[model samples]
Target chain A: MSQHSIAIIGVGKIAVDQHLPVIAKNPAFRLAALVSQRGIEQAGVPTFRTPAELYAAMPDLDAVAICTPPSVRHQVALEALNAGMNVLLEKPPAPTVSELADLVRQAAARRCVLFATWHSQYNAGVEEAKKRLAGRKIASLAITWKEDVRRWHPGQEWIWQPGGFGVFDPGINALSILTEIAPEPFFVTAATLTYPANRDTPIAARLTFASDAGLPGAALTAEFDWRQTGDQTWTIEIVVEDGTRLTLIDGGSKLAINGNLTVAEPMAEYEGIYARFAGLLDRGESAVDAAPFHLVADAMVVGKRETTDAFEW
Target chain B: MSQHSIAIIGVGKIAVDQHLPVIAKNPAFRLAALVSQRGIEQAGVPTFRTPAELYAAMPDLDAVAICTPPSVRHQVALEALNAGMNVLLEKPPAPTVSELADLVRQAAARRCVLFATWHSQYNAGVEEAKKRLAGRKIASLAITWKEDVRRWHPGQEWIWQPGGFGVFDPGINALSILTEIAPEPFFVTAATLTYPANRDTPIAARLTFASDAGLPGAALTAEFDWRQTGDQTWTIEIVVEDGTRLTLIDGGSKLAINGNLTVAEPMAEYEGIYARFAGLLDRGESAVDAAPFHLVADAMVVGKRETTDAFEW
Candidate 1:
């Protein structure tokens, strides 16, 4: 088997910190080129200022990973798919569900692999959690994801703009993991979104969910806030019908059961994503999961809005 | 063929104005019962305060038309499906996409008929427009839907509350027609939502769309407002690649092409809905088109927000 030639688009923080390093070590893919507006380039790789240039120069490129902002990802991926190239999109796929839906259609129509990767769902703990809760009925589940936005996304103005998702940027990672691990599908029942006085998006949100086959007294809820100053927390706790408890901590990188540590390991999320993408490309299949994105859009439509203190850099 | 015993849930404005009359005249259904929170009742029909009571009392009922508020339709229809009854939902189906998705799943799993009726799509003019646009390329499209909320939705506090779509309540009608008539799949590209200072939902919106196969210079847009005081307007104008302009007005009840009126008739939308429902029930299949609902949710997620003047009853 030969390695698939792939180019990385958008050489921003996530691409440099995670995607580039992971592709460098992965034997399934060879880094062919870079398409960056900032003219960012890598050693021994041709760089283009636009995707059209990349497609023209490397028409035989097997695939392209789009790491652009959520707002522009749809157009970028659509152009790549039109050029008969497999495409991979970063988390929160596109700003709108319709854009993502269009990409799914285009990918299938063009017979190209389209992988919408949620980096958090690639952890071993998340996979184990999904396995453990396969046939079990959930009595209750709670997700608490609170972090300092300035600490993680400093000087990122796009996060506050329209289509940026604001606090939902990190909150969707929790939803991605929840969708991956939940035994039954859940829908948002109620929500309250808190927007900064000067921002176009919410800075915090509280959501309640209901499952199809949930038992009596079942409670499903999530709280996401970007105001945490210290001790960042990203955790999900689930209680099954048998009263056994399972907890996923550190954004699904560690797992514990009944207050006992069961699995704790350093996460190689991007590596797992590339591996899955490789498998999908091999089978000529597209994996475009809209559950996590749907949940966020559901919260936005069904949730009540409140004004909070204005956020600042 | 035997007449199916059906019940009307949520005896509200729509139920009284449309569902009862249509069901009374339709030969395929028998009005079995009514579920109303306000204890509203009709001549020669059983009335129950809750769905639980209705289900317990009428276990043999074959189907139910859920005319409840969009916020509670999911729960009501789910229970009806659980009781082995087919369900038909009003326009917009549910408040969130997730809820509607759940209903579709439940209906399929239970082998019950689930018909999500977009009343505007039931018009003869809309059907004709769809037929004319089939296999044709779209050049441009515009939707203008403006109405006085005070006149149409007078004293309806739910229209201003959370989970209430506000202006989108009427705007979705235009979208329903658009989804029915458009030859190619289109997605929301940009939007601006205007919300009253004292309300939870938007009072006006402007949307821009992009199509997969749209011609160059194609401009697709919509303007929805609830502040119109005089004559109401519900219109859609479309231009194909061949430069023929097609127009639909009066909420999809009338159509014109190139200044020539082609189709115009009194709208019997509810009657059309029941006719379709009977066909779906007979075939044991479900028709849940989420395109219109998805566009609204997509706009909510991707659109910028603006604060307008306070709205009052």
Candidate 2:
């Protein structure tokens, strides 16, 4: 019932753009502090340079939202969980499944709620689409998530580094939504990952998936690229056996069924994330879904690799 | 207990070399049938071209040992589970964690035992090492598993394909032992994977891991390579906080503690695998240890990728 004091770790672009504003609007969470290497000063909140300093200064903090890149998320999240703080992690959770699994165990051992938040899964229309497609037999599905890395990510060099996930950093958002909406579990049957000649991560990928049990001739495919220059497209289209087609565009912020617009609303992904985090803390549960990340890992595991032209910012 | 009628799926090299012998020696099981695409005939036993035919011919079969490649294991396992037959999968289980997880759920739903056997964990000295390391503070660990791919795998083209796991096929055996022996769970911190210039999978990999709560300065590392030519090496060395050094060599067939030989015995990995599978079936439970495979998947997810010299079979 009381406001949960939450701190934001790694106050980078996402934190400034999405998390801060959402936290400001959500009465359930109060922004308690900011942890960053940069000497960022907030008008009315405390700021610390590291998780250790934040914990030391604000031992009473109820929770912390980690906005760091996936590479360093596990360490920061572990520290918060060990310090008895309910923790919320940004998308893609950790760089590896093992780290996320360890954090889940640690959170349970410490009786803390750890939420591996998939922000895109909280897009305004995601729950609506999930409800609509609950029992429908999916005849076919396609995900087209193409974005220009230059415009979206700019100079974030980490995106090109190993464990940065490159295109998967955005591609995984599509996967998260797909996993949320799919009626049955699916596994990657085949994939081709195209890496820039000079980068450690892929710049584009094509994935084919199949459900364990599906109608004859049913299929699922995803095409993800970081080279789209105009009108960044993020869309998922699903055709049901009953002839109803469902489509979610704009990273799941809009939904259409049978070629008719059904739900198109303003984005509130981060707000939903915080609300869910608060509810998890209240219910004494940990919401750590590794499905989306597992798909990404599976893609990396089974994906055939090819080198493409060198990418430049 | 009556002997369980068990069919061998994917009558490949492993099935012929390991599974058949083990099933023959174990009176608890009877070789019911063989399923393979190859039209090879085994004396005095039934043979079928596919799992469907095998199941169709022998609907009363009690169990099936799936020795298929990891890529196709899930499909076969699901069929067996759905048919109410206890299933045992070879190591590296399914190509992906999601597939294995789905199989686990399917087996649970059907009330059929699903055993994801990590045969190396059943190595002669592995259980001994696990018992000896229990409750001890592990200061550090190093796993060196280098083998000649040509010698071990022969002309196995799948080993170089995506999802074949390349060097990790052997490396996961070491991980299974480590996961069994470690006092606590550990997660990969950093990794370097070297793929051959012409291959989709890594030819060699180096990984670093750390436990969430361990002795100060504790560390673990693994080096796996497929290029070793002569005197193939498979070893794991561990140092306890009290300066006790433990070593397992010859793929866990030999063990030494504090530089003194502690265990040296012939391997019965496959026999042990069958025994565990039978035990699971008897107990109406599933033994799906995803730890080792999770480690491999995590390595792929986080490891830095480097292209090495082209590999020639």
Residue B273 error, candidate 1, Å? 1.6
Clashing pairs in 1: none
lDDT of 1 by residue, B1-313 (tens): 5688999998988998999999999999999999998899889989999999998998988999898878778888888999999999988798888788778888889999999999999898899999989998888898999999999999999888877888999999999898888887778888899999999999999999988557877899999999998899999999888999889989989999996999999999999999888888888879988999999998988788999999998
Measured against the native two-chain assembly using Cα atoms, what DockQ does each of the candidate structures obtain, in the order listed? 0.73, 0.78
Q: lDDT per residue, candidate 1, A1-313, as tens digits? A: 4589999999999999999999999899999999999999899999999999999999999999999988788889989999999999998788888788878988999999999999999998999999889988998899999999999999888888877898999999999999898888888988999999999889999999988546776889999999999899999999988888989999999999998989899999999999999888888889988999999999988889999998889
lDDT of 1 at B192: 97
Worst 10 residues of 2 chain A by lDDT: A211-220
Candidate 2, superposed: residue stretches over 4 Å from native: A56-60, B1-3, B37-45, B53-60, B212-219
| Pairs clashing within candidate 2 | none
10 residues in a row with least lDDT, candidate 1 chain A? A210-219
Highest-scoring model, lDDT? 1
True contacts kept of 1: 0.81
Instruction: Give per-residue CA lDDT, model 2, range B148-249, as digits (tens).
Output: 999988888988988888999899999998888777887887799999999989999999988743577877789999999889999999887788888999
DockQ metric, candidate 1: 0.73
